[model samples]
Target: MSEQSPLDLAEGDPFGPHNLPYGVFSTPDAPEHRRVGVRIGDHVLDAGAAAHALGSPYAALLARPTLNPLLAAGRTAWRDVRRALTAWVTVPAHRPDIEPLLHPLDTVTLHLPYEVSDYVDFYASEHHATNVGRIFRPDGDALTPNWKHLPIGYHGRSGTIVVSGTDVARPQGQRKAPTDPAPVFGPSVKLDIEAEVGFVVGTPSALGSPVDLASFEDHVFGLFLLNDWSARDIQAWEYVPLGPFLGKSFATSVSAWVTPLEALTAARVAPPERDFPLLPYLDDADAEVPGGFDIRIAVALNGQVVAEPPFAGMYWTAAQQLAHMTVNGASLRTGDVYGSGTVSGPERDQRGSFLELTWNGTEPMELPTGKRTFLEDGDVVTMTAWAPGPDGVRVGLGEVTGRIVES
Candidate 1:
């Protein structure tokens, strides 16, 4: 009897044909020659090789070492390529040529799929923002006056974004306490993780032209899991007048795979109701499609699940974020990425960051490993998520994990 094909995945595999997320990978035999790859079951299909073997017109786009080419091809091309890819792996007649291009995922090295252009992270979760405010300013309102009016965000360092599995060296910076007269310099004693979902920009927008809410899908390619590593001590000291700098810039980890935006059709839901009237540019009350996604995220420390933040509860949506981000006429580039800042729900167990989970270290969570408030030097934090897919299938967003190392 012939052996079963690796392509024949078990029923309901998350990374099956419906969820063929893209990435960049290299084999041990040709480590330097990186190629664009697609995930299917436990294998990575060399997209460029498969395209070439099948005489696909997108061969040039997929043939590149990075995702930039395909990303720049815009929405139409993205759809066409995705359709072709789905057919390539699912249609049996093409299986003979495609099978040779598949490599065991474990045998390959995954790299940062795209060269990040600009990085921006937004405080879009009302629950997370409120929790943070209550923790920091007990006397004042839990949210800023501008919180509900628009999406609050800040520019981040793109150079520091690393692919999952990379070790995050503890950042050294100035930190101060309420009792300290002067700040002290040292490695962060309160390193934390911000569980986030990141959107990758595909087509570029013209400079000085604003991208409205309706146009979000035209320019964005996909979404992925992101861990915005933070140094809470450093942030507390420096984030008063300005915003997150050294505390957040040191490193941000992203999943190796990028789940295409199209695959998440079934995940769309209406965002939390707005408390204040939105500006015409920021309004989405009548958007043909709801902006929120139902991506359920799990934050795990040392392989133990600590929290499950629901993306559906976020007040601001990626569409609104994109509309707000480019509303200033700041042009969008092909590889620009923006994060849906720490997703948290109304419940405590749904909190997405160590800061809120531990209530700013005042409450230590008991885990099998030990009591933990903030991340230790050897702590490993992994975040994984899935969204509702067509026919009740679950679309996996993959995981982003990183170990904290001493500075």
Candidate 2:
């Protein structure tokens, strides 16, 4: 928590700012495959190398060739990594022993933070839910009838969650013709990005065993930034009966860093008040706090800022979603991923996705360079987040950077 740790801390650098997010990388020039690492002051300390230097149980997990095996070690090992990292990065510069482990960030190839086995996305933000509801239902009713009772979510395509710097291919799917009553096939014209936070599950639950809401935190290891790329035209045609299919399954982008929960302990905030009480099973008897992370989120298009919002605006919490998912006694496994649905604020300008930002694409978002509407090929999109705290900026997660690509 001390700001005077002899490391050059940036004013708002989330990586070193109390919260030490985890990531995978190899030195940029080393190889094509990624290796595990953590960020600190514009540098990435190779986890394997740092752990090898630390020795013992810590080294055991880090020395492994990949994070998938280490992630399978569960929470105890996960916590050990965080504790060791906190100590290593905080050492005074006078200590010459630690320099060999940390490497400059520019020299690393960031990879998908973890090997995700499954992915679930939660519609947690109240403002986002209400705005989207208004767009669809539009009779002055913002919350759906079932909205207050449970955390709504859907299973996502884990195979497509790529790391930053990857190019996203424009998806092609079916869309309805305005004049005709049928559908036609073509490349998506309404591709949009949803700003979100994704958490990684570190532990496992048996197929028929349920995880209680109160204990849901134990099942999670850490969080990261997620961009749930969507093709609106395709979605409109396919979502009516079954929810997002090829429209959303084609690609999703996430930051390579998986910022651990321990680093974010100082940034927890109480979840929003419920309009209606939750069921006894979903309740947190400990009652110390509701549930929510306090990470501030923002999105940018080709270096131009688009939206700056907070995760606090969410209607539900990850804990509740995890609890609800297992209510039917479904099992969960380590490396499972969960997304906090597009985080939007209550205001119009603060909307999280292009669908809302451009008012369903009716209004074009004017950029400084004079371009507008949905993303175009070669346009880059970036998302970043951090939580403010006395210890420094408790960075919740890192970011995802992508350029549009032709189909």
Candidate 3:
């Protein structure tokens, strides 16, 4: 029998030809020489090298250390490059030249794929918002009066964004208890994680022009798993008049692999029904493409499964969020990222954050590792997810993980 080729991926492999997520990597032999790579099964294809070997026109875009150039190329180029990549891997004639450029996945080190220009995170899940409100304002309405009208978001610190496997130091800030007459300074005792899906912008929009809901696909390049680490104590004390600050600005983690939006065609679904009429700019009643995605997220703490948040149940869609974001004429730039905030479902096991899962520590969770209310030093949090793909296959979003260390 002949030796099986690395390109000959087994059936139903999430990283098959149908799903060629991109990343940046460097081999141990040349640690500083990073190049763009595509995940295919168990191997990473040296995208730039393969493009040069196959005499592909996209060599200029692929032969780079980061994904920003390709992202700035706009939607048409993105489609063309994806088509060419699909052919390069699926077509037998190109296999000989492409085979040699393939590298074992374990032999390379993955890095942050792009230089993020800006970061914004949205509170778009109704279930999550309601739970948070109920926990904090027990006697008041769970849903805020303005919650249904627009996607509430806050600008986040882009400098703290890190790639998967990075360790995060516990942040120190001010916190106050009802019994205390004043606030105290110390490391966060209520460390938590918010499971989210993030969208990466590919094209830039003018500073004065608003991007409508219909232009979402034209600007977004891909999607990935994100962990918006939070310090509940710090946030509760600081986020009074304004939104999240030091608690959220400390660190955020993202997956190395960015799955192209085109590969998620089958995952499109209708978002949860709205209870109130939306404004003209944020409305999607007559939109051609469905706004919701059927991506299922699994969040684990210390290697044990704790929550499974459903992305499809989100109240606001990415398109609406983009439209709302740019409605004020805020310019879009390549490498800009926005997160679909804590994706929780109606069930208890579906809550995406420790705040909701443990009811703000009023209840403790029983795990094999012992009882827990919030993250502890040395605790590792990991998130992984998959979306429906074409022909019954699955499109996997790369996992994002981080370990908490002492401040």
Candidate 4:
């Protein structure tokens, strides 16, 4: 838990001083350039401007309008900036200088916080993996033979990763019917959203070195909301030999704010125990500060809460995922992003996606709008989450939201 900032936070506000999530924003008055800022209540403190005004190194770094500078500065610098910002607001002598940089949240335009160099999506949730496997292949095992041993992930298209509120167009791709001999090309019919939590890599690693579990906080910047939009029908036809491509790449939306990893101390939990024998790399993920978080996530359809996907339900923790990703000697970059795929739990209401909740459309979800198996045109899907905060309060992670549009 972190110390509270003196600023008056809103009722149910997740953007307290402990959770001063960072992002980039611009207003119509200053549309030509974007500024790095932190969220607190209804206002955004222009960190870049504050740093510039205070004559700090963060000012120069934040001048570029992205979080890459601060992210690349490493742990000591991140903590220093945090403390400085806290003092700027909380300390009476410095408040006058910092107060001028604050802007109303509603008046600014939020943009993608960083420039993503690469993207990876991991299938770490046991319930989601099992439910998806059972529905897609009822006759086969619910999980793969090696699922318990390793974190399964795939490289996602970083170019198409959009910020929240960006419209998602129904993807057009090649699809072949189960009985058809020919492959057909058309717009996707089965569009779904995967409620995910993304981890941003702040520091880069050498090409040949692996990042161990203990070093997670040192290299990772923070967590943000993510929605890896999937085109299920297209994926089904093309995923037999190679993994996802177009079906998964059309657009993946992320939250405007990136909550620092430091704020989630109270939210940390021990990940589930592994059933397999000891592997040298993945050893003791449950011991001392495990990577799992007690983030309560809700998936809403047209403003109605449809499901509550549990982040704690994840089988493989984020620390393990980071280790596995870099164990193969894959290098990291400043803006690299990775996500926990489709967080789900044992219950039906805890399902993350429509595919699982509706059992691949065989059963439909009863919503106020109507009975829905999947999203329809104009349907809005929003994912929001809050973790245990200091003083038993809750810290908000903001949200990742998007609406389905016609092809």
What are the per-model numbers of colliding residue pairs?
0, 9, 0, 0
Lowest-sum lDDT 10-residue window in model 4: 3-12
Q: Per-residue lDDT tens digits of candidate 2, residues 303-354?
A: 8888987887677777888889899998998889899889998887678898
State residue 283's C-alpha deviation in candidate 4, in Å.
1.2
Worst 10-residue lDDT window for candidate 1 reads: 3-12
lDDT of 1 by residue, 1-407 (tens): 98878799988888999999999999999999999999999999999999999999999999999999999998999999999999999999998999999999999999999999999999999999999999999999999999999899999999999999999999999999999999999999999999999999999999999999999999999999999999999999999899999999999999999999999999999998898899999999999999999999999999999999999999999999999998889999999999999999999899999999999999999999788899998889999999999899989888999999998
Assess each prediction's global lDDT (C-alpha) against the native: 0.95, 0.78, 0.95, 0.88
**TM-score (C-alpha, index-matched) for candidate 4:** 0.96
Model 4, residue 195: what's the lDDT?
93
Residue 180 lDDT in candidate 4:
90
For candidate 2, give the lDDT of residue 89.
73
lDDT of 4 by residue, 85-200 (tens): 77776667776687778888888999998999999999999999999999877999999988998999999999999999999998999988789999999988778989999999
Give TM-scores for every candidate, taking all chains together and pairing residue i with residue i: 0.99, 0.92, 0.99, 0.96
The better candidate by lDDT, 1 or 2, is: 1
Candidate ranking (TM-score, best to worst) = 1, 3, 4, 2
Error of 4 at 27 (Å): 1.3
Model 1: CA > 4 A from native: none
Report how far residue 227 has shifted in candidate 3, in Å.
0.4
